[model samples]
Target: MYQRYHPDKNANDPKAADMFKEVTFSYNILSDPDKRRQYDSAGFEAVESDNQELELDLSSLGAVNTMFAALFSKLGVPIKTTVSASVLEEALNGLVTIRPLPLGHYVSKRVEKQCAHFYSVTITEEEARAGFVCRVQSSDKSKFKLLYFDQEDNGGLSLALQEDSAKTGKVTSAGMFFLGFPVYRLDQTMNSIAAAKDPDTSFFRKLDGFQPCELNELKAGTHVFAVYGDNFFKSANYTIEALCAAPFSEEKENLRSIEAQILSKRAEISKFEAEYREVLAQFSEMTSRYAHEIQSIDELLKHRNEIHASYTITPFKRSTSKSRSKSSSKENKEDGQTREKRSTRDRPKKKKWYNIHLRVDKRKAC
Candidate 1:
């Protein structure tokens, strides 16, 4: 599609030129992950929100300038570059203002959009051994980039990107990024230096296990550049500072006391942990013993219930005294009546028979 829409090939057709621009714009958006994601989620509005493309007429430029521009663009440099190449060149030529940023002191500056501010920090060998840190704090909500320079062998300075606020977003109402210059110490007794010199070791692997020292054993003078880029479309009001990790006399004494206190507390915690484990073991043992005793008691109670069920005892009956007295009086009265009737019958039978015989004898004598 890009070849079909080549403006050079179809110079007579204006539509081909427009198609070429559209194809380039689409390619730019699709090539960048962030822009592509933004375009996918929110369409062109999000991808183009605060950014405007730089339109250059390639046909109007000289052949050499146009060739270099095309080369830079092909090398992944955005046409609307965030970091100004002129600023870097001016810095290398010593044309830009370079301020001295004292250790532990922050300097604030307002840099115009698409411009760069440079600051130099000095470090001693002793301070570098201990370590140091450099950071930039954005005073306002704006996008910017921080960079440190490395001296090349050809006496030119090369810029390395340290942090870009546009990528990280804001940490607070302001934005901040830590520029740690970690010190890597190679063991003298081993072949660690040879290992470090090994061609196969990747750059990042060599940086592993580094201590937090920003200007790690660097020479006395170094410059860091902070740039306010066109990407976010605002000037940057920010403060930058470098801090040394070396301790002062009073602080060294205080740190020693604090270290002593920390060691004491750690010992106490270790002792407490041991005692806690011992007590926990004792508690578990007691719990087991109690559970066994309870089980034994429950068994004994069940056995006693079973034995009680095996023996059957009859229930006693209780009578009142008044019912017994009534029965005895009734029996005595019946016996008295029976004896009186028997006596009357025995006396009457003898008297009646004698009287009848005497009356018969008197009648005969008359």
Candidate 2:
């Protein structure tokens, strides 16, 4: 409708064009389900009010069920929590017998490497309640499995950074610790940029040496691992093996990793700011220079217009009998008179008769 009723197309009546814009705005809002729902349910005022509320809550019932299952497994008790809808009443009644929820044992397991171990990690149930960390050794230079989960329901397992691996997890090492994070590729075509921007944030969280695994128990798929320093390890034909502990001894490591990330991000921002300033300064300088040039051009154009106007009244003439120098001198005198009228206060300046002749020839050609 806008194209149909644009003022240029429908000079007789353009009011319909405004309606087209309004319709487009309404359609944009209605296209999004959340925005449409907010608009329908609460109108524009309520939508604006709701945007300020950001608290998110999720049910812990699923995790509770997993905890119960893990506990039953450890105790050598075989039980299934899921029941048919018909037995729902029976299940609810049976729950009365178990007094408060039970916290399962925080299991800490250690794997040893043949090489001299420089680090060891230990995490208990208290740590696993939220999340925990562990370290594993990589025996293969090109490829190695870091996590193996036999049970599909083993919970989410997160593999943290390789501490002593060929990679340097520390940020200060080479400004490339982000490469340490575990990445999953659907195919070989995947590059590091794609892996970093991948929506599967579950894998990227471990770039820091301090992130908790989502899987309560690390015993699912055969997971492979690598580090940024793999190139060095590959050349040396050496492997990295380190001990890992979980749930963290305390939150200090987590805090430190987070701090390091913040600092790194800040450094990047500073670098960008410096570059931005330099570009901005260059742009400002260029803009000023352009403005001065434009002003000079405008003054030159005004003088040219004055000369053209004088020729319009006086008309052109074909000179004859005079020497070439005399004809040139006569043209220069006319140009100087025009310049004098335009710049009366300024002293006489050198004139370019060639430019005037060229411009006049162009006008004649046109």
After superposing candidate 2 on the true structure, give the runs of residues whose Cα lies further than 4 Å from its correct spot.
1-37, 41-264, 267-292, 301-305, 308-314, 317-366
Top candidate when judged by lDDT against the true structure: 1
Report clashes for each candidate as comma-separated counts: 3, 13
**What are the lDDT figures for the candidates, one per model?**
0.55, 0.36
Give me candidate 2's TM-score against the actual structure.
0.24
Question: Stretches of candidate 1 above 4 Å error?
Answer: 1-81, 152-156, 166-217, 247-366
Best by TM-score: 1
**TM values, all candidates:** 0.36, 0.24
lDDT of 1 at 168: 32
- Per-residue C-alpha lDDT of model 2 across residues 1-366, encoded as one tens digit per residue: 334544445442323422332343354356447868888987866444322221111111245433433332233221212212222232223321111111222222222221111221233444333333333333332211232112123322223422223233421111111112221112111122222243332233323223332333322123322222212112212232222233333553565566567557656765666777689799999999999999999999999998777856555454553566697999999999999888876767668877665425555755
Question: How does residue 246 of candidate 1 score in lDDT?
Answer: 67
- lDDT, residue 39, model 1: 93
lDDT per residue as tens, model 1, 253-292: 5644664565566567656667866897999999999999
